[model samples]
Every structure is written in structure tokens, then in C-alpha cells.
Target: MTGKINSENGYVKVEIHKVFKVLLSILLCFPVIGMIVLILIDTKEFSPILIVVMLLQVLMIRYIFIGLAFKFLSKDSLNRLRDVLDIEWIKNQA
Candidate 1:
């Protein structure tokens, strides 16, 4: 889907692409799913310390992806993207 910005009644509306949304969702799920499968497949192979480390890693990855998703979907991010893209140029050309 195409991205668009609309301003009505002093509010700005931005439509983000579906592909990006889907990608973020996948990223958010991957680490948790991977860790779950790992634990299920070999609970005895990992020591307690190693399991703790792995859990920490999963949490860190999940946190990072969540932050990225929120940042990308935030209003400030949309405004920044618009500024970087120079929407006025496209408008002028049209």
C-alpha cells in the first residue's frame, strides 16, 4: 500500500505501508519463538547460567524490536520521514 499524509481539522493522518508493519511484527515474534523452540528441543543441553544468558538475549532482542516498531509507527517518526522526503517538492511538482 502507498503511504499518504492527510491534514484535516488541524490533524495530520499518515498511512504506513503494510509490508513494513508485517516485517516489524515478524521481527517482534522471531526471537521469542526461536528461544521457545530452543528450550523445548534441548532443555538439558543448556546450563542454568547459559539459559539465563539466552533468556536475557531474547529479552534484549524483543525490547529492541519493540522500540523500533514503536519508533517507526510514531507521529514523530512520520513527521521526520516527511521532512526528510521533502513533501513540498512533490506537491510543487504536482
Candidate 2:
């Protein structure tokens, strides 16, 4: 837990890193979002509720992908995230 928190820049650096990862993950889903828009446009029907629902679904999908990537991609960050969430991890001592 302490390892993830650095006193160097008052957490601004860590926060920025988190934000960058979130933005990058969302940006990665832009292609899918574009396809959704194209499909709606091609159908020649415009529904505000449908558009909102689709966008929300895309956001949740992006969030799930980002969570999985963080968990599998970087163990360190995963642990850090767990720490941030106040999840307790048992330590085994030999």
C-alpha cells in the first residue's frame, strides 16, 4: 500500500496516470462507438433514448475492458487498485 503512494508530488502524478489510462481505454473504444453511430445513421431512425443507452453500454464495456486489462496487464497496479479500494490482503510469513 505504501509502495503505491509516493510523497514526491502529492499524488498528482499518480492521479494523472490513472486519468491517462482511463482516457486511453475509452479512446480505444471509439471505433466501436463510431460503428454504432453509423448503424443508427444507416437505419434512418433517430431515437434519443436509444442513443443514450448505446453510449452507456459502450461506457460500461470500456470500463470492464479497462478493469480486466489492469488486473491482467500489471499486477503492481492491480494491487495498488485493491489498496485504494481498502481491500485487505493476507500476508504469509515464513
Candidate 3:
């Protein structure tokens, strides 16, 4: 325990790192879904720049997975996500 409380029932307490990992893990799925949606739908009207940006975002998701697989990193390190609000790790994000 970090001696910090983030809601507890005396049976379970969530640590700052635990919450950070879970949120990042869940959000990493978004890019996959976006790629699928793009594949399934027609986007001929979309500008070339927009399509390129979307593909770059999709590519960044792979790096995010790699970062987590190697070491604990903040969302800023992950690049596509934001730091958790008011969480303890926000200060160490850099």
C-alpha cells in the first residue's frame, strides 16, 4: 500500500500504478477499433492529410503497447493518452 487511499472497503485498495496500467490498457484498444471502422466504411471524401494523420495515430498505438510491455510509463510516454487526473503519477510523467 502507498498509505494513500483511493476508495477502500478494508478488503481492497487500488494503487496509483494499478489504475494507470488499467486505463492505458483499455484505451489502447481504441486505435484498433478505429482502423477496423476505416476498413469497413468508405472514406473517399476524407482529405489525404486526414487519412495520413489517422494512419499515423494507428501506428503510434503500436509504440504505446511496446512501452507498456517494456516498462511502466505515463500516458505522455504512451503519446496517445493523457495523464490520469489528480493521480499520484502525474508529477513523475516527465
Candidate 4:
């Protein structure tokens, strides 16, 4: 993904490329697709608990990617992202 950044009057504006947005949306759909396939393949044995667990696993995978991304960022950039997202737990990690 590519981003254009602009700052004015202490506010930061980030513009994400449309292609990047499309790619990201596709990437995010993989887990959902997998879940659908799983359900389709085993309709007779489908369980709500299994679906919930799969969803939790997908969320964990997403956060793992987010953590990895933060690791590659500079301290200032990480701080900026954490602040923008308003996620308090990230502050402790930083």
C-alpha cells in the first residue's frame, strides 16, 4: 500500500491509493473465504463454537500483522499511528 501524507496546522492528512485499498480489502477477505469453505465442506458437522473460534483466530492474525508492521516503523511514526488509532495498549508496548 502507498500513502501520501500532508501536515497543516498540526493536523496530518493521509491519502491512501485506491489500488492499495483494493488490495487490502482482498487480503482481509481471505479468512472469511476460508471460513465459508469450511462451512460448505462440513455442513452436517457445523458448530457455532467452531465458527467463533475461527473468527477469534482471524482477529489474532490481523493483530499479529499490525504488531509486525509497528516493529518496522520508526519510534515517531509508531507513536503517531498509536495516537491516531487511540489504542492505549500500544503505548505500553512502545
Candidate 5:
């Protein structure tokens, strides 16, 4: 099947398995729990601060990984947008 995006089509087709989706949701809970812990605590200490920062770092890394994965997975849509814009630019130039 062609993964190319068309005007009639919305996005590139990328198959994400159900198992991975479930695992990803489970993994996301760690950060949420960490945030809840941080919110419940009242402290001016090093260890809790460190833990929160580490949790934030992990969440940020996860976010970046997901974003990059989606970008590469839906590249056909990006290419289609670029092509459409290029055509418009050429038409305007002429």
C-alpha cells in the first residue's frame, strides 16, 4: 500500500500496535505519579527536588522521542505539504 498522502487523504499510514500503545500509556503513569508526589510534598531539600527533576527529564525525553517518531512516521504528509507549498510559490513567482 502506498504511504503517500493525497489531498483526499489526511495523513501517512503508520501501523502502531496495540501492545505498544498499552505499554506507552503504562510508562506515562510514572511521570504522573512523580508529579503527584512532588505536589503533595512541602520541602526545600535536595533529594525530592532531584527526583522531580529526573522525572521531568524522563518525561521530556519521552515527549521528544514520541514527536520524532510521529514526524518520521507521517513524513508523507509533510512531503505533500511541502510539494503543495512549492507549487504555490512557483505559481506566485510566474
Candidate 6:
């Protein structure tokens, strides 16, 4: 099936999007894997600040992961507008 941004009679974008989604999921999963590994294997004492910082980093990655997953899953129209829709024209209309 062609996606919202597909070329007529060509499935390139859809194929690319499927591949992109898979790759993105994998990319997003790696951080969780690393965090789990650190929690499981790291015996080196980390300060409270360090633990908090690491947790924040994981949260940051997870947030991006969720946003990207939503964008990929949505049929284009459902996307939450972000940088791409931050039009200067609209912003400066005042």
C-alpha cells in the first residue's frame, strides 16, 4: 500500500517507510537495552546525581522514541505538528 507521501504507481515510499519504521524501532530499543545492562551489570558506585542523570537520559531517548513511533504509526494526518509545521509565517502573522 502506498503511503501519504508516495509517488504515483510506485511503492518506494511505502517500502522505505516500513524499513524506516523497523530500523527506528530497533534504534529506539537499543537505549533501553543499554539502560537495562547498566542496571544489571554495573557495580561501580554511581552518585545519586549520576543515577538521576542517567535516568533522565533514558527518559529523553524514550520520549523521542515514543514520538517517532507515533508519527510512523499515524496515517500522516494524525501527526502532532512539530518543527516541520512551525511556520514562521503563522508565527509572525501578528
Considering only N, C-alpha and C atoms within 3 Å, which residue pairs clash in candidate 1?
Answer: none
lDDT of 3 by residue, 21-73 (tens): 68766676676576557766856654556557766775676566545654464
lDDT of 5 at 53: 77
lDDT of each: 0.61, 0.59, 0.51, 0.62, 0.60, 0.52
What is the clash tally of candidate 2? 0
Local accuracy of candidate 1 as per-residue lDDT tens digits, 1-94: 1344455212344554688768766766765677778779998885657657667766776667556666666757656766976664233222
Residue 53 CA displacement from its true place in model 1, Å? 6.1
> Which model is ahead, 1 or 5, in terms of lDDT?
1
Report the lDDT tens digits of candidate 6 across residue range 1-94: 3323222221112233577678766766675576667767875853456556666766776677556766576535323332354422112123
* Superposition TM-score, candidate 3 onto the true structure: 0.32
lDDT of 3 at 69: 58
Task: Give residue 46's error in model 3 in angstroms.
Answer: 11
Model 4: residues >4 Å from true position, as ranges?
Answer: 1-17, 67-71, 74-94
Instruction: Give all TM-scores, in the order shown.
Output: 0.42, 0.37, 0.32, 0.48, 0.39, 0.37
Q: Can you list the residue pairs that collide in candidate 3? A: none
For candidate 1, the lDDT comes to: 0.61
Q: Kindly list the per-residue Cα lDDT of model 5 for residues 1-94, writing each as its tens digit.
A: 1355444433334555678778877776777676667667845443556666777767775778766786686666556755864532112122
Give the Cα RMSD of candidate 4. Answer: 8.6
Off by over 4 Å in 1: 1-9, 46-94
Q: Is candidate 3 or candidate 4 better by TM-score?
A: 4
- Highest-scoring model, TM-score: 4
39 Cα displacement, candidate 6 (Å): 1.6
